[model samples]
Target: MLENYLVRGLLIGIVFGVPAGAVGILSVQRVLSQGAAAGLVTGIGSSVADVFYACIGVFGITIISDFLLKNQHIICMLGCMLVILLGIQCFRKKKVEKPASVSHKKQEDRHQPGTIRYLISCFLSSFAIAITNPATILSFMVVFSMFRIGGNESIGEDIQLVLGIFCGTCFWWLLIAVVVSHIRDRVTDGFYLKLNRIFGILMVLFGAGIGVRAFMV
Candidate 1:
């Protein structure tokens, strides 16, 4: 009973959420550097992906299982693209000067895009990103499926498990945001200039490498 599949899913979310949480530092850094719109885009994009992966793990594993196996190279290519795009964004700098009125917190926070828009877009972006990498779900499916009981099921119990997992995942991201918000000062305007050039070039190189490798294959 203790080693049940539901309990296992709960644990998996807890564990994976940790490193994913850790990288969140970079996510927050990216947000500060990129601006709220971009940061929300990236964050929600990843979050949506995680949610999709969660669904695939529970429901679409069989369908996704085969597609992933057949298109492993394409998957790798997509992953490369995502990483590069983020890197490019991470390093890039804006030329246009935001007015003092816009930059100032009291005015800026209120005048900016609505929170709902930010949230919806963020969810969509993360969801699409996660869908592209079904492996995340597959990995989870493998673990939870391992613990699946071959008897009567409880829908109520399943819901509880899922909610727990999501909360666990959120905990990880929230922790990341906290740490990142702390060091936002260190990431200055000057740093962004050099960072962008380096990451932009490297990201493209990474994409090129993936294409070259796939082409060879």
Candidate 2:
């Protein structure tokens, strides 16, 4: 029974994480700019937010969920603005001229004095972007209902499910980071610039769509 709960949770997590939303674009951009570690950290931040929403669903925290749903439009507006701003930043970001080896060394040095700051910035940005979408809880609720989860379940079972979700989400992010990092060295600066512009445009379009939806709701 525990295994069933865990496996279901894992599947749901992967399904949720697989979408190439703003968070996904940010993760890929970070991988191209910084390294695999940056991308993974960004994804971890998003995963943390996902776990928070998942907890609300698993524990049936109706009060919080209700409140979030009530103000979903405002939350979505904020998210839209945030995403658009990030998209602009991505679009305007200057390409790194230094060779990969030099950049890698500099990145290594960043670990010495600025590691905590860098990590916090990356993590918090993704978390903020993710948490603003209060609709995520609704998605969780729907998915949970479909899976027949969280109703009169033991605390132990719920905990197992949540842990499985975390593991599954983290695994997906790690895979993305690893794959992107492997190709990081082969890509030229021009390619990186082009990708940045492309992703930036996509993010802005995504934000615009969200904004429109927010108003329609």
Candidate 3:
């Protein structure tokens, strides 16, 4: 039974994470430009948020869902604004010249994200953006309903389910980071910059669409 739950969680995570949405694009772009660590951390942050939502779904937490649903328009507006701002920042970022280095090892290390700013940007910002998506929670609710979870279930079992979800999510992010890291060195910086601009434009468009939908609602 435990193994079954774990497999289901893994399937759910893969289904949720496979979409090349704003978060996916951002993760890849960060990997190409900032480094694998940045992309991995960003993906982890979003995954954590997803796990949280998964927990809520599995536990049938109606109050929180009700509150979010009630204020969805406001949340949508804020999330869209933030997405637009981040998109603009990415679009305007100037490429920095690489410094002359004595060793190949040093040059390699320079590409990885190590700064506090990058960590915070990748982690906290990703969390914020991910948590703002009420649709994710709804999707989880649908899945859980299909699986018949959240009905007089033991707390321990629920916890195990949530843990399974977290693990599954982490696994997906790790795969993305590893795959992207392998190709990070081969791609030219100019290509990354152009990719960033494209992603930025897409982000802005996504935000605009959300904003329009919110207003219409």
Which candidate number maximizes lDDT? 2
Which should have the higher TM-score, number 1 or number 3?
A: 3
What is the TM-score of candidate 1? 0.65
lDDT: which is higher, 1 or 2?
2
By summed lDDT, the worst window of 10 consecutive residues in model 1 runs over: 93-102
Models 1 onward score TM values of 0.65, 0.93, 0.86
lDDT of 1 by residue, 6-102 (tens): 5655666667666342124335544555344444444545654565566555554567667764675687567657656655664564542212213
Please give the CA lDDT of all the candidate structures: 0.54, 0.85, 0.75
Expressed as tens digits, the lDDT of each residue in 1-217 for candidate 2 is: 8888899889888887783789899898888787888889999999999999999999989999999889989988998998899999899887563236465677567667576687788899889888988888988888888888757888888988898888888888899899988898888888888888999998999899889988987
Candidate 1's C-alpha lDDT? Answer: 0.54
Better of 2 and 3 by TM-score: 2
Candidate 3 wrong stretches, greater than 4 Å: 96-114
Residue 62 of model 2 has an lDDT of 91
Error of 1 at 212 (Å): 8.3
Give each prediction's root-mean-square deviation over alpha carbons: 4.9, 1.8, 3.1
**lDDT preference between candidates 2 and 3, better one:** 2
